[model samples]
Target: MSKIIKKIFISTIMVSTTFSLLMGAESIEISPSIDKKIFHEQYVSVTVKLNNKNISKVLIVTDKNEHYPIELTTQCDNVCSKIIKLRLGENSIRVEGYIGEELAYEVKNELYCASQAFREYKEAPIKYKERFFHTDKNEKLCAECHDMSNNEQKKVAFVDVKDSNCFVCHKAITLDRYAHAPSANWLCTSCHTGEIENKSKNIIEKSKFIAPKQIASACFSCHDKNKQSWDTKKHKHFPVEAGMCTRCHNPHSSDNKMFLRVNSSFLCLECHADKKLSQQIRGNSKCPGEQKDGCTECHNPHASDYRFLLKSPHVDKKIDNNIKGK
Candidate 1:
């Protein structure tokens, strides 16, 4: 009789343990599963579904350092379901369910914030439109893939393509370098189109692409008529022969007017190398033997309305003619 009592007691203990494990498993269901790569600053919503109608009260606990807990209650007939919003960095949620005054089940599972889920979602889309702008063979080909049926979306894509395609070809040059290049920034695209089979096979074809004369033509694309008129003048700077605008002028701003690379006399002395010219000008005295005399007293670096880049009173034609007559 004592042996029968002992066996019955052991069986009862086993049954209680099995019941407790099953109830613990059924207390919560979290979706999307858990993993690493969860960040601390994202918002998340967690839902808990209760198993037995007898379970009336639920208590939740989390690590206070990472997340704040928010209590949620939903009514259904006589029973209430509870949800707790928890923000935990490296802690688990503990859920304790109670029936009236008795504890029904105690369960725990790891918690993850929404930031991890968002990162995974972002990675899943391989071709996100926000990051890459697409182009085609004619380079007008974005309309083929973009949604043409939707007018608003089509306009947005067209604007993005127009603005971003320049960067695609000119990526090799930094903005500062482009700004200071002999031909200004906007004209870089007219010549260096990146297409294969041109005389310059591509933008990378150094020997053909960096030809000084072709770079000059890039400026003439907009200024051809102006250059043609200037060429008619008898005296011209040698940069006209070498096709080098940067020889006389910095394409960007300068402390001196007319965008000349230096003050007038210093600029002329670059080629003249005359010690008298430097000494005469360095003393802040006027140029010798002429009124309003300076480098501009004689020559024009660029084509001039007057004979020598000169202002009104100095625009004389007979000075050189009379000197030759002597």
Candidate 2:
């Protein structure tokens, strides 16, 4: 009887040790799903299915340092969800886990926001129709952008030969970088048609398919451009070639010269944030807002034709003026 009691006590101790070890080695898993694009709204909804427990806190943090508390849809499990308000451009959403006031781990994702309406086929919003004035009028001609008949039967394939339909309206597309591959050969469908869903951030929803929503991935698919950790130029403006194409150039329409959103001078100032430098650039010690020479006066916005992306070589200003006049 004494031996049996001793054996039972040892077994209980082993079971308790095993249970504690299992509890201590807690692992957390989160499955996040996002809609990539939100229609006419500033906020996007995210559903995060979590396989975690003992989470003292779970918060959704944005790139702008805005924190939003995530609430579990069901207490029975860790399925959580939230609606996050986003800025105009790229918005990074990070999920942070905390255990009893202690920081645990963080998972991050990204989504984009734009007032640009891409969905006009199934449900045409008044604003979207107004924006694409021509496309709205030509709504009868489905073949211009999509195939209404089952002859092609593709989920998102466009009419093959009429790929230049976009060019009909956007005649001013800049040939910068010699028309990047995806844009070349008019295989617009390859980049425009969605692999799974017929919706992407950049593409207007047509049939059952659309282009890649993420601009960078759509570009890099054939452009061979990769994001580098460091900028190694004589004068590198971080945003240039930063895969933020729409920042400076209209992706489809070359409304502004050089495919620029605005002239380089004015565009640069938007982020330069240095009033003194703007004044100095304009040779104005008094009024910075009034520019004497735009950014092109000295700096080459695209490349360094002269040193440090300068527009001209270092020479006496008077001499150059005299030479030009002569």
Candidate 3:
């Protein structure tokens, strides 16, 4: 019985020694460090460390789409350190260790990588930012659709006005739809000079001019032909001459047809206070008094060669030729 006990103890000790030797033969340790945050389109370096003497192979697992690993190997007496170069975007890196016939352990480093491309880019030409104007998300001007040349004058005007920030707030105006060419080379500053007021009490005020009719002047800058035609007609509205085009026309595209502030006869009657003329119109005659045939039967919203803002020859001789002709 003693002989049997001694034999069993010897067998157990041998088994323990063999297991320790096997573990030591295939030992591997890895240390990985990466940036906490990454921007779009940037490079990242992953550092790896191992403890085994004869490492046959090392594999790094990452997303197939974004990063391709560039393997770098450095060897010391018994240890090795590797640097893997990774491309931008989000990816994960896992280091695999291998011996001659045994699969060791794996160390995983997960990271979110992004491209830093946008940080070095310039501001878009048509970019606009408005805090209180829009309830929706602020619209950014993308250079994709906006014209860079049209913004040159606006840029200069911004500099002259000393409110370079204005370009940042107003949407870029396109010249594609203009009926005529722009007059006064880069003339935005000539009309919009007084809109921004200096609030600083320390600086002496330069001038106390009425706000230049920015909206009207903007229209006439390109539509000088329309302005001249309208001015030649009789019964011209004072605001049109005063450069208050926005009182009737919206600069931006509108759901309302003709880009008028309000649609239909109500748009006309808003200022045309004649009560008798309001009652005669058949469709949507919401005006207060007796409307005549229609507002357009007499007046031209834009411009006409005739007096009293008439677009065409009037039907009735009494109203058209006799009464108003005088």
Candidate 4:
């Protein structure tokens, strides 16, 4: 009986040793991401997809053994993923996998991130689809589109992708389906030259285009023919008063009436706060009783163009106090 017990113990030890030797980091794969710029971005998304189901636990170990557990989801049968955020510059990530707390495999890789937006090389532009035939063929402006006898522009033969150059061929934005009054009348200098030319934008370098504006006054330059300022309105939509014209209206032209980015009903409810209350407040309009059709059923979006923009008779006009009013 004692000999039998000793034999069984010896067999168990042999099996455990064999299993350890057979266990390899073969099936495990660690995908690495290349260095990327994160200019004006919150975080550099460094995703490392690990493929191996045997790994039950994963960790992203950075410098100083700072272990961050990787939260993974199954993409397919044998794939796991987690996005890791790293600061700018050299990052050393050590990925380790475990089978129920026992370290099974490990992978080491180096990655770099940058917060600057400078590129040493860029792909040459071969696809210039914007070179469509111009409708107006009175080509008197030579310097506008072409390099006049090599005045030493960056590209001698090719027209650089500049808005000033674009106007030479694409001057017909004003003739759009629903052209803006300023654009249709060829009044480019008002908005583009005075406002846009001075503004800084994504390039962070000096350029001709104006920086995009957020203040309402920029759009009010032409949109409100009455020259009525949002500040002076008795009742103003939050976005309109805030000068977010681009929120609802398309910048150029649209097939939709009034150049709306989307249908009015859907656009209004996006920020109206309460959907059920909005339906009650809007009341039944000429619309065919589709409650989901939203706030534009009766209310004129820009202002109280629809009978003083008052609350619907269906809605109990109440103030912030939440008390019902007539």
Candidate 5:
């Protein structure tokens, strides 16, 4: 009888230990799945389906290294859900479920805030997509952030109701860079007018300056044609004449001087690569040749009165020989 009682006690202990281990081992299923590439909204609704019932707490970590606790509606039944706001660029998120003070399980997901960026190469960065505007995918919230009414005219100010404005989310774009005049002055309506009426900001894959005429209208609207040297100069850069300013200059902001797409001399070399003139220009005695500040030393970027867009009419024999490869 004593042996039988000892055997029963041991069996009960084994079953209890197994049950405890099963309860401690936790896992989760996230809705919308983890594979979703981009979320266009400033706020994303996430639903987490849990496998364990004892998970009493939840924590969320953002890409910016922000940590916050989200209250779960149901601990066991139904789905645990939370609305999360995302920052610009890539967002790496970690969702951790906890029981008491101990971490039960953790999972990670990645998302992107779709906004317009430079489209120099064949594709934009994997984390970012080239989009026309920054409106919410749902709710069509243009009025929440932008100047929808024509009363604002050229100036776009933040709406007083909910702290909504362009800079609220997109301040990173111009950080540590020289912003364009119109961009710096909150003159978004100057260029972003038309077709934005009551529409969502989901205009991805559409190039902002798709047409040369549109580009000309947006640029020359602020830069008066009468003051420009293009008309006065005999020789003109084809991009300038064609009203394709974006080919050479970034419309928003740039680290490079004069909002150039790249450093001055290298920018000139990008197009001149086909001519095999990079080496000749670099070694030429008549040229300044410093990568950062050379091309503009002798050549006028937009146009010039002299041939070869030379800054001055007096051209050197060496320069002429370098150009002709004599």
Candidate 6:
């Protein structure tokens, strides 16, 4: 009985020691995983997993032996990712891990940059199928459009509006779509001026594209006539009165009519959340006589002369105090 107990304790000690040795082995893993060879975008986010936690530095070595040091915020426990810019053709990258001056571990990855041809290949991963807005053609010209300087007083979204370079690559925004008037004219600064009113709630600190807190303020600048007309109406939609126009509308270009985020009925029901209306629209209700045309069949989205923002008079029904009325 004493000999059996001693043998059990010895086996447990040997197993624990072997497990610790395997866990401490140094290695590096690179991804876009070697099997998926092609990447649609020039800039690819590569994740490196380090089994040895002591590695203090990470670097990418190109096939030509050019070493680019990657800045790590901290010595990562196991994983760190960086956006690496790849050359236009077949390329090889070696992700190397180091402790101070000495190399610790390294892993190699191969990738092909074929932005245009990637869309036609159906087998490509969904992430790599669509070409990113900032592709190879526009990669180098970022400073041309963006405000690169850190001047506190003169910081704007773009460097200059006189020769707007946005439309050069973004011409597809207006192709066969109902473009917002300002977007059609390439006057992006009308909304995104990188300056907002001091008191506005949507002031994002260090924002890449500075837009107005009150989106309606930008819309009313051009649509002053509509604002003046809507202001006097007896009934107004909550979002419209509160100047939250983007709740249902897309500020940028949209394929939908009137630049709606989705079809008017679906957009209206999203906020209204009436079980009866939702069931009727979805065709799941047992009640047969349902109006499929949706909320606009009775209620106007923005403002109406009648009660409940109705397109026609609804004097037969009782008024609800919860709804806003002039």
Q: For each candidate in the order shown, give its overall lDDT on alpha carbons.
A: 0.45, 0.49, 0.44, 0.47, 0.60, 0.60
Top-scoring candidate (TM-score)? 5
What is candidate 6's local distance difference test score?
Answer: 0.60
Q: Which scores greater on lDDT, model 3 or model 5?
A: 5
Per-residue CA lDDT of candidate 4, range 40-104, in tens?
Answer: 11122333444556678778787657677866654334444444555444557666777777776
lDDT of predicted model 4: 0.47
- Winner on TM-score between 1 and 6 is 6
> Model 1, 135-227: lDDT tens per residue?
232222323332322122311233333344333333323222223432233333344433333443433313212234234565576569968
Candidate 3 per-residue C-alpha lDDT over 103-147 given as tens digits, one digit per residue, 9 for 90 to 100: 464555544433211222212122221112111121122222223
User: Clashing pairs in model 5?
Assistant: none
Candidate 1: lDDT over CA atoms? Answer: 0.45
Q: After superposition, how far is residue 147 of candidate 2 from its true place, in Å?
A: 2.1
Give the C-alpha miss distance for residue 80 in model 4, angstroms: 44
lDDT of 5 at 144: 38
How do these models rank on TM-score, best leading? 5, 6, 4, 3, 1, 2
TM-score of 2: 0.33
Cα deviation of 15, candidate 6, in Å: 27
TM-score of each: 0.33, 0.33, 0.34, 0.37, 0.53, 0.46
As for TM-score, the candidate ahead, 2 or 6, is 6
Tell me the tens digit of each residue's lDDT in model 6 across 209-306. Answer: 45654579888987899999999998889878877676666666667888875677667656665744657676754322235556676677899898
Candidate 4 displacement at residue 105 in angstroms: 41
